[model samples]
Target: MLSETPRTRHRRIKENGRTDPADLHAVLAAGQVAHLGVVVDGHPMVVPTVYGHDHERIFLHGSVASRSLAGRGEVCVTVTVFDGLVLARSVFEHGVNYRSAMIYGVPRAVTDPGDLLYGLRLLTEHAAPGQWDYARRPSKKELAATRLLALPLAEASVKISDGFPDDGDGPDAALGLWAGRLPAVAAWGTPEPDPRLAAGIEPPPHIAGRAGAALHPRRPPPG
Candidate 1:
């Protein structure tokens, strides 16, 4: 799992070098939105948008005229999810346990007709599994107006912080402050169908299946 240098290690975090690709991919898959950072006019700009991945490449889309997607050079993409808040006894040690991925690479515009359609499918399905098949396919005019970019997972990094904080054997512990992790999780609510739909319309299996599932702080499916 080691590619360049491990970033999850305590020393690497201290050195500010992240190098775990699996951690990076996991964070990316867990998140539907990403902050795309790129240089504009020699200044840094981060744009928030939706993203999708196929385990080997990450896909992003925007309007054909979007500045973030229309530039002539490389772009940096990052996806982050905060699993919980780590409230340590010491204020200095308080932090968040999170999963994040950073990708640095040049994005190639999707041109081939087949690849473009595939990328769009990936983007839609990433937002919600089984959604693409359930929804109407994009029309020719719609497809022509959209822009898609794909970045290979060749150069990426993941950093994750988990478990309780380092707060024992400190003066703050003696202060008798209540300190521990305040767990945060994302869960989906019951589906509310559109009022304009046909009277007999019922929740589709794909949409209805998400009930009681975690939206953030995602967990692996049961065996």
Candidate 2:
């Protein structure tokens, strides 16, 4: 179960709030990019970055000089997967179907050589499953120029909206109008080889196999 702190308490739309830890993990795994919110120079800044997560924590990295990766005080990381658009007879009843999670905590900078290398591998593998093994690993000079941070997944807020318009049972139902959902799905496209590649070179099976695969697989509802 996910701990419900003051920051995670849902004041409105309580029904949409999810307390299960699995739900949080699912949302994080399905997303590719996360927005990291932090205070820089006393001003709020939100930076988009790729992230990787284990069962207990998430890893984020960027250039060493990046202000957002300073690993300072409190921070908020959010990941969202847009599912679809819900259309209703009335404008007020229109909504969206999506899965989103917000995590708040203090992140620590990864400094140890072994831990930094491990974290970097995780981040790369998360973004591209087999690419990490296929591509050359980062060198000492490259590693020195990168900054990595890890944040605990202890406190988080998860919200999933997948229902149809509630106006279906209300007066809006009687209106002579078509109302439904326009679903959105993301899929991987064919791989394009680099122009500098040799003529005989081609994408590996692991990369080519995902050409038509869904970016985020649909999960079943809880029992």
Candidate 3:
């Protein structure tokens, strides 16, 4: 349940609007890539890029040489997941059920040296858990050339849909047209080490495991 406030109600959409903060957080955490919508030079642009979330805020990184991050004012970010395909009796009524989160806020460049390093670590870990420790940390020069942006999740909305289609009553149902849901999921493939890797260099545990095992399946069990 959400606080009974005008702002919350304003963002609420019938059936689609999700008021549970935990649900929203889960969806955000489940995703690795986010599409950032921003107004650049008065033109709207949506860029797909990797992101990391630290419970309270979302971190987005870009090359310091990239203009998208250098000249941004306020940015609108959206993360989404397609759950399944909803097939209805009528073609016009067919649709896909999905979960999505929209965040609207101003992005401030991370300036503090300590916070910058921490944010970078969070970003790195978000993409590859345990990789931060396994790989060399960024040097001062590398850090200097990286741009990190943090956006608070305080003002955001989650929309989700599950189950089958909603076809009109009477004639639609009587027509006996097939109606059901086709589930969709994401899976990871087996780990393939670099050909140049030393013969003794084994895959790290984190790398050996699938990224989205819960959503998908592990490697076709070893023969």
Task: Please report the candidate that would top TM-score against the real structure.
Answer: 2
Looking at model 1, residue 28 earns an lDDT score of 73
Q: Model 1 — TM-score against the truth?
A: 0.88
Per-residue C-alpha lDDT of model 1 across residues 1-223, encoded as one tens digit per residue? 6355342244555433445555665677688698999888888899998877876788899999888887468777888887889888877898888877777778898888899888988888777789889989988898889999898777777777777867777677788888889877888889998889889888889889988888864543111
Model 3 per-residue lDDT tens digits across residues 1-223: 4333443454434678877777667777667688888877778888887877775788888988766676367777888887789999988878897877787778878888898888888878767778989999889999899888889877777777886777756479989778999988777667788889889898788878864465422112111
At residue 89, candidate 1 shows an lDDT of 81
Q: Could you tell me every candidate's TM-score relative to the true structure?
A: 0.88, 0.96, 0.87
Q: Which tens-of-lDDT digit does each residue in 74-107 have in candidate 2?
A: 9999999999999999999999999999999999
Compare the candidates by lDDT and give the number of the best one: 2
For model 2, the superposed segments whose C-alpha errors exceed 4 Å read 219-223
- True lDDT of residue 92, candidate 2: 98
Evaluate all candidate structures by whole-model CA lDDT and list the values in order.
0.78, 0.90, 0.75
What RMSD does model 3 have? 5.1
